[model samples]
Target: MWSGPPQPDEGLPTGLSAVSVPWKNLGPSKGHRESPGSLVENPASRKEAQGEEHSAAAPLDVSRLRSSSMEIREKGSEFLKEELYKAQKELKLKDEECERLCKVRAQLEQELEELTASLFQEAHKMVREANMKQAASEKQLKEAWGKIDMLQAEVTALKTLVITSTPASPNRELHPQLLSPTKAGPRKGHSRHKSTSSSLCPVVCPTAGHIPTPDKDGKELSALVRAAVEDNTLTIEPVASQTLPTVKVPTVECNNINTCALSGLARTCHHRIRLGDSESHYYISPSSRARITAVCNFFTYIRYIQQGLVRQDAEPMFWEIMRLRKGMSLAKLGFFPQEA
Candidate 1:
């Protein structure tokens, strides 16, 4: 009665399906025993078939899920790269700012070093100048002390001479150097404004009594007077004349000087002076003061004058101007006219 191929059953036997079942017995009428739809389909057999289909679809679902996870991983990696790039850029900018700050600090340090070095150099210069000034001041003080010591010695010598010397004449002429000395001959380059002006002018020294300008004879006379004013010796000695009347001078004592030849020689220091002829006649022994002082007497001066030492004619005038003559008394020595 059925014409089409028979319907498939909901379940099929193992190793046999509904399609294998002959729907029509076209080969032979005896081979057809049942139709495809007429086959028995149990509930257990249908469950087994459905379970197999579900198992077959499981692998496809897993494959699809794995592909979706791969896509998600790729997208996340791109976002991570962008975040890293932004962080690195911020770091680079911070590094540049740090480098700028370091450069500024180094420049400031260099400038500070230079300023400190300059300050130290200036302080060193000031210290050096201060030391130089201190040294110069010390040198000046030493020279002044030396001068003071020399003046002290001169006072002792003046006291010695004042004890025995005779009074000077009231009619004594003026000192040659007191009233403006002779003008020196002009030098070849006189207009050059040289420092020799001190040499030309008279150097009136109040302390050393009378220090005249440098003349032909003033140099030697100054040296002699300086020795007397120095209180060191009696350079110009009077002659001892036996033919003329003898004036006895008592043996002298110098408490100021007690060393060397002047030590025990006070007894032998007595001498009979020839009045009015008080020229240098004999040489006396020098004391322990100056070595050349003994030989630098009037005799030596006369010899030097003969050998072209010019006129020191102001010697007597210099002696007169000095106040040493005030204490001198010729009447004390029993000379020509005795004083009242």
Candidate 2:
């Protein structure tokens, strides 16, 4: 019943294959075996073939996964680079801001330093001016104190004299005409003779009825009067002379004028002294008279100064005034008057 090849299971047992079965005759004829409907299969063998195909595909899948992992790593590297660039930019901005702030702070500090220096200079100038003014004021106060001390000494001397003088007498007041002095001039044989007790010694006579008897008080008064007149400390004229004899030298009161020529030892003789008879004994040489007159003139000048009659000026008269005053004071003490 079979054609070219025997049917593989034509007389096969129902439960088992023949014992002499050939491997080439294991299936039906080739034409039937190749048919989809007649193809023989077992469950276990199909599973085994599918497992082999899966095993062969696993290496390709693993290769594809590895390639995807490499791509992911590359993208992560790009992200990291971008982040690093942003950080660098922020750091640069921060550094720039810090530098700018430092510069601004330095400028402000410099300005403050300048302002402080200016203020200190101004303060120093003010202090110097104030010190100068204070020093000037102190100098003025010292000068005023010196003047006050000198005046006080003068006052004390006057008080001492007034307390020690004598009491009055009546006979000395009654014959006061004998003490009267006549006019002084040049005349031959002018027969009036007048002498003063005060002329014998420098004595300041008492007022009318104020003469004392010869006693301790009287002697003390005479001594004090002599001392005062010799020292030129007292300005009182004796009661014996009514008018003081005037010298011929022209004198001008020192007003506000500061400079004037003062003759030291020059002399000019009067006409009365130039024409003289042999018996005319009233004569004083011009040089001798000038020496006496210079003393008188210097004392008068100092009195005027003490009375505040003259105002000092900025001119060169201060040296002259000081010299003359010192000379006059020394002359009153019976010492030689120095050259002015």
Candidate 3:
């Protein structure tokens, strides 16, 4: 039995009364009533409710999805920026390293050039020093060779003198008398032979073929002859004048004596003079020739004295010739004549 339509709140909960309708009032009303079981449901109303719920949930889901998508995009952008920064930093570092390496290479090349230049300079200095030393040594060697040649010549001259000076027989008289104006008488044992030009002693006079006598006119000539003998200008021959006997002659054993040694010495000296003339570099000037001639004359005098052919009084004159020869030698050697 239905008492009119049940109130809306009769069986429903308080909050659901607005949306839910009473099942007893679903159909016919007044004298006819419908049972709760016979209530007809509306398909359109259910469909509308479900559609509204679906629409509300869809909006919230869409907002959440959009926020998530925004977060993902922001994260991706940040990561890309970080990666780009890292790449740029790395590129900058690599560029700096490349620049540093290039600078080092340039510096090394410069140092190498400097070292090479210094080495070349050192080598050049060494070569120059060596060349200078070699030149000095060569000059010394030439001087030594010249001295050796001079000594060898002296040795050869001595050897020839020894060979030529053979002792005469013991019985033969070493002193032979030549033609002289002062001879008093002939000896008993000696035979007097006619005087010939060949038997005459060779005399070097200022005037050829003119013999100086003790007469007043020939006094000057005599003085000149004496001076020539003292100065060692002439070779010693057998004394043909009584004046030579007045001078103290050196007495020596006549054996093993070379009378021609003085002549050979003079010849050698003359040969040296010729050599000096031929090789101009060896003798610088005419003074050098004069010097050589003086030496020859001095040696000739020495040879005569050694052979006991000169007077003992000629000792002083020998010293004078030696002094003159020394001066000439000094001149040739580039020293002062006075110093010599």
Candidate 4:
């Protein structure tokens, strides 16, 4: 065959010439895989490959990560510390609350004890007062019963005396000398006999004075003496005088003074009776009569006290009346007109 020229051997060593092969003759064939060492022949390429490998194998920035982790741990520790502080503060507050409650409970218990003791003392005092009142009431009841017994005995004795007494002449038929007038008699118009008669009247006699016997018939005198002795209304005693012989004169008994005074007051206050009329009428106005009746009632109360009918002490009725008159002016008491 005719070659174009003498071609150098290209497939030989660095000094060998290139040998041209026909491109159509090169068939399809598997290419051989090259090793990394064989592929990286240039210094620059080797450096590049080593750089990539280092980049892939290199670990993360350990210093930065360690710093971040430390920061996170510090933050967590701070949070924990804050929580602990809050818990301690809450515990302290709870302790203080508990102490306050304890103090309040102790104070309440003390007050309750004091109240209980005071209530107990008050109950005891009430019981004692009730006992005293009961004792006093019982004593009063006994005294009242004793008084009733005494009154009954006195009534029985008086009834017995009345049954034994002799009947006397009519009270009206008794001489004016024997009967006493409530008011003062005329001073100038009396003869000696009239004066003697007035003196002999028992009602006119002073409390300390002796009553002379009336110069009446012996039968009448004996009857009067007998009546007086039996009635216990008057006491007759014989007194020897320098001028006169032993004479029996009538004197008011001390025990009968209250009865005599009451009778005298009643007589003085008696209603006016017309001679032929059965009805009696007071001369004074009703108001004045009421006042008189009040006075009589007051006297009656005093008499009851003196007679031991009531428990209260007996004040002198006349003294009280005088005190009332002195303390209360007529105008103030409405007795006289204020203008007057």
Quantify all predictions' global Cα lDDT against the true fold.
0.41, 0.42, 0.43, 0.43
- The local distance difference test score of model 4 is 0.43
Best by TM-score: 2
- Roughly what TM-score does model 2 have, to 2 decimal places? 0.42
Ranking by lDDT: 3, 4, 2, 1
What does candidate 1's lDDT look like per residue over 68-150, in tens digits?
88999988998899999999999999999999999999999999999999999999999999999999999788767656654
Question: What RMSD does model 4 have?
Answer: 22.3
For model 3, the superposed segments whose C-alpha errors exceed 4 Å read 1-48, 59-63, 154-340
Residue 301, model 2: lDDT of: 53
> lDDT tens string, model 3, 1-340?
3334223435433433233323433547698877555544444554555455545555665677789889999999999999999999999999999999999999999999999999999999999999999999997887677567556545644432222233222111122221121222333332333433344333222122444222223244335434543444422112111222111112311121111211221111111111111211110123333444455556655665564444457668668677977866775574643211
Question: In candidate 1, where is summed lDDT lowest over 10 consecutive residues?
Answer: 252-261
lDDT of 4 by residue, 56-175 (tens): 433334455677889999999999999999999999999999999999999999999999999999999999999999999999998888688668745743442233133222232233
Query: Which runs of model 4 end up more than 4 angstroms from their true locations?
Result: 1-60, 157-340
Relative to the true structure, candidate 3 reaches a TM of 0.38
Q: Residue 46 in model 2: shift from native, Å?
A: 2.5
- Work out the TM-score per prediction: 0.39, 0.42, 0.38, 0.32
